[model samples]
Target: MSIQAASNSEKPPQEDNYQPPSSLSSLPDDVVLNCLARVPRSDDLNISCVSKTLRSLVRSPELCRLRSRLPKKSLYLFYHFHQDSKRCHWITLRRGEKMITSTHDYQVEQRSCSLAGLLTSPHFPTFYSSGVSVGSEIYFPDHGWPFPSTKVRVLDTRSGTIRMVPSMKVARWAHKKAMGVVDGKIYVIGGTYGKNQVEVLDPETQTWEFAGEEKVQCNSRFSAPLEDKVYMVDLEHGRISAYSPREGINNVATERLIEHMNCMCVVENVIYACFKRSGLMWFDTKLKVWRRLIDSGGKATLCSFNAGKMAEYEGKLAVFWTQINTNFVEKVDIRCRIIALDRVGEEIRGKIESSGSVATCSYSITLSHCLVVSD
Candidate 1:
């Protein structure tokens, strides 16, 4: 009896010592990365806290490459508000799975993503200045206004870390300045009051170099990088100029594309510009011609009170417009329209795939700046 009792005690101890399988930890690095890549980037902060391996994977370059392949698309909107003081917030809008009907019709739903501690950093910039995003980082030029100081604020979307990077060679506020990122270098075309100079910054080295001086006056308020060249729109002259590091600035196209452009974004190597009254127009770099994109049955019409901003989202052009009403109880109505482009014969045309009002807010909300970033 004593021997049997001792054997039972030993069996119970052996059972207690047995460990369960760690399915996740045992997964291959690639498999683990593939799984984590599908997760929303906004949740990376909390996801990384799970373990050291996960934290490293979240910051790994391979994971970013995997994320770029995932079918799910996320559009992050960064907006600045200032009623009494300067403040900014990042709102993530994700496109839900497409539902198809038996009639061969489909619908895309846009929903706000839950982001916790993503934009809560104290170092986030509050001022509304011109900015550009390259890879996973966004750079904002902060030339001390009223007082000349050279400083650039850089925001890393992955970890939600905002830090000040090396300033530009010259102290220039990004307001009304032409900025573009090419070949991993940030080029800033400065010199208001008729003097045009080009400065380039290498983020890798955290250094700035003078690219060259532009012969033509770069008075454009918007600039975007396409392929190897940078396109700058001259609203005053109704011309678009292409700048290359090897070659100087050259006028590519000219059109009276309205006196003022609300915002501009590049999609599929073509530049699209939005006007307050004239509607939407695009510039064809291949033909060096400007053509009006008809709204195809009033799909994109702007009111006098509507303020519109355009951005390239997942190879499609997205326009976000907000109408503010002082008399109405509802202060602002934010509307978004996604346009998909297709070639109808020889002419390229866009059709509105999805359109709806995304959100509404009180009158106290002041949208100073907006930019779309993919996560």
Candidate 2:
């Protein structure tokens, strides 16, 4: 249903001179602002749809007082596609931006330069994967197994200047599986590194340090830079944990063990984690509890929602699945229909959207040693 229709159906009671309930009516504006800060980005939009008064309150810049407490701009990711044609292109998507749009394609000039320069070659998972930026450098690690021989390079995208940076001396660091930045340090976590180790890189000094071995089971996906913590998933066992440097780089298992967590993403401070077997796991940082999202599951087979390949787009959690037969990539936003936390797992709620070309082969792999760009 359209947002307008949904709002009209739940029209709030209107009193001639309605004073909201004493609880809400008497709340200081600042107190109300704190409540709004805890709401997920999508729910804030729903508040805009609820009523004129609420819409105004939620949209006001005054509500952003808590956002200023954040240390950095919400992370922006640019996924590059360097097809096998010796050409490279990129699309930049900021977490707060509305959409991902194609930009420009740059040519791969060197055969032995950084991995981004190897786009024209036929090595799979070369320059495509989720990555984060620290200072002027962006790191893209190999996503698949038997990690390719790569050289780490930092790029001045503006000047198209590429310079080699510190790389893991050991091979297959799972450099592509997941990456995050915390306290000015870069953490490269699990993929296919032999025995699974977390590789920490300091961009300021151009150096690399081996933090420790990854504890989660192999093939279990993990995500980092969620609030003050980095999360690791025991996918096969349905367990979860977070890493905090304040405590040490060691993985500290969470008291809440969620099963089958195949896909994970963070919005604001909460982690929206999805499991293939049990459905969606809603982790509230403030409450320190597990609220199962039951409404977002069930239709996975019909929706072609694989519990992998999810990305946050424009402040909404987008789940992506590839259709092999049609060579299509599809996405769904589960935020708009979230009525309660338990529904995150039980209902197949939200609008499903798809994009990209029919040819899946026309893709780019961002490698740890190379950068992938898409136009």
Candidate 3:
């Protein structure tokens, strides 16, 4: 009993079991990278917080190349259910590694995650062009949405600088599917009170001119461009045709395709459709018939479930679908699948590389419009 040394101030005893944490740096960069490559991307953000060394490693290009073990497709999804919950979901389609029970074979299970609230309500783009090839440069009217203007402003994707470009021949703009990019110019369908006139702008010369007066009338609100041709699908008219920018030929084909398909897209000069009943299908240009999609595991069940929309990403087919809960009071689940294609003569095989859920919303949302985008 050291009564003389027993002062009020005292420090807690150190636990002998405590030791400094191990560092990944202790391991070789290649070894660390190999271990990290197996980690789920969802956990990467958290792992980056562990140490400064890890932060650099996780964000490094080396990790990116390694993490890209399988097919990679970045998907942007917009769902408008209510004005209050105005948020956009960004989904990352990545490969997940899993070892089978006792076999050496590995399974790539895609856990599609939606990063919600990525965009605000005011800044959220009210884009109507379903087939527009809008690049990193975000273009809008000199004024904001719902306001018609001839002047167009573009935001530099790299610098994020917004500047006004030349005005169009027609003072027309709208959110109801009005704009499209063709060739090296911007074209405005210009939705001018019953007029079919379109104004074209050349970004290189900074000039605006009128396109052909006899524009093709398309019933589809969505369109997809294949090479030099812009393909439009008219479900009501039961027609899928390719609209030529310079010529009047639409190359109307697949009258039956529009009947079964709800959404369609083109990849590698091939038109693929999501049949309302048939899951996934692609049109045979030579035979003029629809073919089934095969999953990567050599299963035909890839398109067995109903899919909503189809888009091509990174030279692959991306399919989206929603299933209504039979117990109507529950939430609905919206999902997406990316399928890789291999064409051999008349037959096309679709291998589903990854799948994920985009959103979960209430069934009360009777009329919900989903717009899917990929880059």
Q: Pick the candidate with the highest lDDT.
A: 1
TM-score of each prediction:
0.67, 0.50, 0.56
Candidate with more favorable, higher TM-score: 1 or 2: 1
Arrange candidates by TM-score, highest first: which order?
A: 1, 3, 2
Q: Give the per-residue lDDT digits (tens) of candidate 2, residues 1-375.
A: 999989877877674457755764357778777777766555677678766666777888977767555432222222233444233333322224243322111111222223454332344233334455565455655333444333444555445445556556544434235566788787665555335556678877878887765443233345646766676564445455566655544434446464444556665456776667655555655556655443335443222234444445334454433334333344221111112222243232443333332112222233222122221
Colliding pairs, model 1: none
Question: lDDT values of the candidates?
Answer: 0.65, 0.47, 0.54
Q: Across residues 138-193, which tens digit of lDDT does each residue of candidate 1 receive?
A: 78776345543467777676666566777677666455467788887988775355
lDDT of 3 by residue, 1-375 (tens): 475556423534554456788877778888898888877565688999998888888988998788676333333333434443433223333233553322112222222222143321233334333323344444554323455446555544334344566767655533332344668566655344444555666767778877787754444544556666655555356555555557743645655454465666677788777776777777676665667766554555456457655666556676766677565567786666666678655467776555655455665332222222322
Query: What is the alpha-carbon lDDT for the whole of candidate 1?
Result: 0.65
Q: Distance (Å) between predicted and true CA of 311, model 2?
A: 2.7
Model 3 residue runs over 4 Å out of place are 1-73, 83-131, 138-180, 187-195, 201-208, 254-260, 287-290, 294-305, 324-329, 358-375
TM-score of 3: 0.56
Q: Indicate the TM-score of model 1.
A: 0.67
Worst 10 residues of 3 by lDDT: 102-111
